[model samples]
Target: MSADYPSMTTAEIRSKFLNFFEERGLKLYPSSSLVPDDPSLLLANAGMNQFKEYYQGKKTMKEIGAISCQKCVRTNDIDCIGEDGRHLSFFEMLGDFSFGGVSKQQACTWAFELITKEFKLPLDRLYFTVFTEDDETHDVWRSLGVAEDHISRLGEDDNFWAAGPTGPCGPCSEIYFDMGEEVGCGSPDCKPGCDCDRFLEFWNLVFTQYDRQEDGSMPELPHRNLDTGMGLERMAAIMQHKTANYDGDLMQHLIKLGEEISGKTYDADDYSGASRSLRIIADHSRAVDFMISDGILPGNEGREYVLRRLLRRAVFHGRLLGIEGAFLTKFIDEVNAQMGEAYPELLKNVALVKGIVASEEERFSTTLDNGRVYLDEALDALADGAVLSGDVAFKLHDTFGFPIDLTVEIAGAAGHDVDMDGFTACMEDQKARARANAKGDAWGSFNDVWVELSDKVAATEFDGYDNDVIEGAKVVALVCNGESVDSAAAGEDVEVVLDRTPFYAEMGGQQGDAGELSAEGVALTVSDTKNHNGLYAHVAHVAEGTLTVGATVTAALNAERRGFLRRNHTATHLLDAALKQVLGEHVSQAGSLVTPEHLRFDFTHFEALSSEQLKAVEDLVNQQIFASKPVVTRVMGIDEAKAAGAVALFGEKYGDVVRVVSV
Candidate 1:
């Protein structure tokens, strides 16, 4: 709060941080998509997510070091976003990473220099905390001329960092800024790790030097790495001399838009009703915009559920501020205007963002009204201090599309608690019933048989991409009457798996190949080929002599049927592209089915296509087909394929190497 310290905008801070690292010889890497490619994460929660392969030794490090401003989404603190000064559902993590290239001393020194000289923070007010066991980090900070009293040593819980239960982990050193005694607890024990607004932790430097094994042993990594994350909003708040992150320039524009929409003013000093609602609206609008731009739509499960919750929470707060109708979309333009330069994806997907937000807003308007009535009735029926039953909560969610978090919020406000355990039980019960109804007993039994066979047989080798017939393929496993068998006589239905075959299994919405299996003394009629965790099962019935496991046979595919399937599958891709062109970029594939006869493509669209629009799509597809462009297929790394603009479905887990088809 001194005149000597220059106040900087959020954008300036972001630029300066990246430039500082770039000047130090770190290669700049663009932020990865919020929809993480890693299966373990629900969303990209940190800067290190994209560099996971480098740390785990799966992918070799190609650069000495790297820098990025990663856009991250964390919802565990969602319900508390507007209640404090620093929590956010979405934030940018300014990070610099090194894979066995930079030492801990260099990382700590550069971070200190960036904070004091580059950002011009008052050196006297900054405090550091090193892990208790990390003597190397402690000595490094001492060598930097820091007062010994200003640096604190904390325990593992406060200073240890890990990506998960196992994997790359290390001791962490944190930097905290003092906000003066006015915001402190006024206790003598107050320090950097205190849970108070007085000491704000803005950056964490993780020296990843160990690989934690499954047996709970921590062995030193062959090569040490450095990963650090500085929160952009936190830095902005400190640089701008603001007490709250929402008051910073990064979110002020969105807050101003909220005020204009609802005729309410945001009070930075107050963290109560109207002020809190304004802050939630501002924070959630940014999250909603970025999520939609990344191809995550509002829905009821997984990442979609996260987006829907954020959007609905913002909308609910708007209603609290007296906003009505579809007002959430009003913030999209402002979001794009403010963040478009740093993240051009926002600008490119403006129409899609607005369209989806508006549609969801319109849908939630009726849902909110209906859900509130049900909630009020339930709350009224409940006695003071009595918990709301999960059955009623589930009813509200199932019948009215009300989020459970929203229900918990309302219940808490009324001085009541929810039966979360009961709620979880109810949810699991519903999921179990739905699974049983969808898969049926027969399929369940078939899956159980496959599970047993998987232990005895390795994955089937797929040769169907090119060859139509595989000779001398040995049968590895056989199943008859929903049980594994060594042999199946003639006239009995069975499923067989060969060590290698030329049969295409059902995958990616494409129907399986129809073929035949024959040998010197046996024959089987193949009806469908199914993939079971990489094992190809040819569903068939013995027509001639007995077929036994380990029997060498000829696996032949029906080439004519496969040709039809190939054409239909190709049409689906063309149809997908044409729909996007004719409708909008928001048209993402929801589901699909490709068969030898015809194909079904399901997608996300707000409205029905008109006859003229449908005609345009048809014409486009026909034009592509008539042009006779060569279709090329090549296998490449996932990153390379993405660089080539190969479209990927959201939530689909892809391997390192992918087969990409270009038409």
Candidate 2:
């Protein structure tokens, strides 16, 4: 924008929003977090994602009304960045939030006031768009003195906001900053709202008025909210007299830092895609740095996936510049030194965060070479002149971790085009694999009823390791393909139920319990223990006794299986810490399993684990195991646990207190 944001400095924009709301009697809270307690999201995609439980009535208000500047990450548009002027992986949201009650009209009025009165911009430069179906937003905007002509009506796709299938969702009215061009106009003559960046949609006011159902349907919400996010960087670009977002002072500083480290000069030149790579590197490094500092490391799936992609992208650019090693990690300090004051957490754990990035890059560097070699193999596949579809290339990327761009780049180098058809096939197959489940065949009722069973099972104390066999409790329920047997003998299989037992059913990615459920001559070997029709249904692979349905049975978990589980469980913690030490502080565990073969810990870091780094982590974990350190569990307040330097896992909602284990 040629306009110097015509209002305030980046710092002023941040402070003005918070201060205005604070003076209006709203609780001005600092940014809460970038992570979420919800697993459905890859990252804190929205300011409201972390506040979902609050909007869903799962948690009470920390305060009745509050305002915050939140750090948010969105991967939905990952493929669309670099070319766009606005989309970014990491961005700060200047938000005025409310936990309790405040009308949408107030939301509209305050937003209008903040832009007009506080920012001191020309009123004519502002425009508002509301959902045509939302009478409330329309009325509110009108009440706030926005001229009816200045407010455009858009369908739900553009003007309504929903986080997920079932959560707070409602109509949104976006406030736009007019660039005095064709698309910025509210007139009927304006070309649709798609790509003319003439009108930059900056602020959005989402009224959480609906909740979506599991079957992909929407229902009304009781307590609506005012959720808004205006990007600080984008806003700064307009306020700082920059044509492009990357050209802004904030990102330029990071660009300069990235350039210096790579021993490559970044300037406007025809070095093929080198300048683009530099820009991407500069942008993505900041994204990864901020993410790691905020406690997200790179891993395989979800947010970790985003980190992994960013890390690899930056490193790939490094290779293009002839830079080597885990140089991206070293820039963590540069990021901290530059933006740490704005985001202290980045500076606070700078060392740990850097190590995570450094280690991942070192690992991904090799992966990159291998990935390139793998593409060469694909090029070999293309030598016969058979069209290599995107599917085959995608597999090389998926199974072998080949960077997709490298694959395409290599293909282009080989004078061969990729099979766009094959890639789609492979992509669809992966989606199917992700969606398929035993429960899927059971209809929607499977999860609906079974989820209630975990709640129904009396908090059975699982002492399987100490003692697998326990006294019998009454059968809670029965599940059968046919009629119930007399005694469920050793070889005659039958579904033996349990009211309570010491069995630790398969959960947390652990294998199901397999042991004998016995009563006198009726000994049933449980091949699997899973939830069926809201009850723990023990599948006895082999049984002979004709057990009656109501017979009391002793529930036992397999001793060997439990021991294996313990080894795996204990190893998980060891590998987790080792990963942090070898990788970086940013290496928060994403997911892992300790199987009979070996321990696997998925962590958030940009690059893959190098042989040297992975070996170091493996050695460190083994060292702890050999040291015979006691894996001690301590019960204390959740706050105390955090204060005691305990690591918290994602998607776990701890109570006022928590159970923390340390070695």
- TM of each candidate vs. truth: 0.73, 0.66
- 259-283 per-residue lDDT for model 2 (tens digits): 7876666563222465566677767
lDDT of 1 at 451: 55
Candidate 2 structure, TM-score to reference: 0.66
* After superposition, candidate 1 runs with Cα above 4 Å error: 1-3, 214-216, 376-394, 397-399, 403-566, 585-602, 607-663
Clashing residue pairs in all predictions, respectively, total: 0, 35
Model 2 / residue 230 / CA error / Å:
1.9
**The CA-based lDDT of model 2 is what?**
0.68
Per-residue CA lDDT of model 1 for 1-663, tens digit only, reads 333588999999999999999998899988998987565567898998877656755344567799999999997778798988888999999999998889999999999999999899987888999999899999999999888988999998999987567767899999998888888999999999888789899999999989877899999876898999999999998899877788799688888888898999888888888889888988899999999888788888778988988898888888779886788877888888889999987886787788888888888888988999999999999899999999889888777778787798899999899998888899889878855555222112222566556645788988778899999999998988777889999999998988988998887788988889999889999999998656799999899999998899999989999999999998988999999999988777767899988999877676678999999999999999999999999999999998999998643558899889998
For model 1 the TM-score comes to 0.73
lDDT of 1: 0.86
Q: Relative to the unseen true structure, what is the Cα RMSD of model 2?
A: 8.1
Clashes of 1: 0
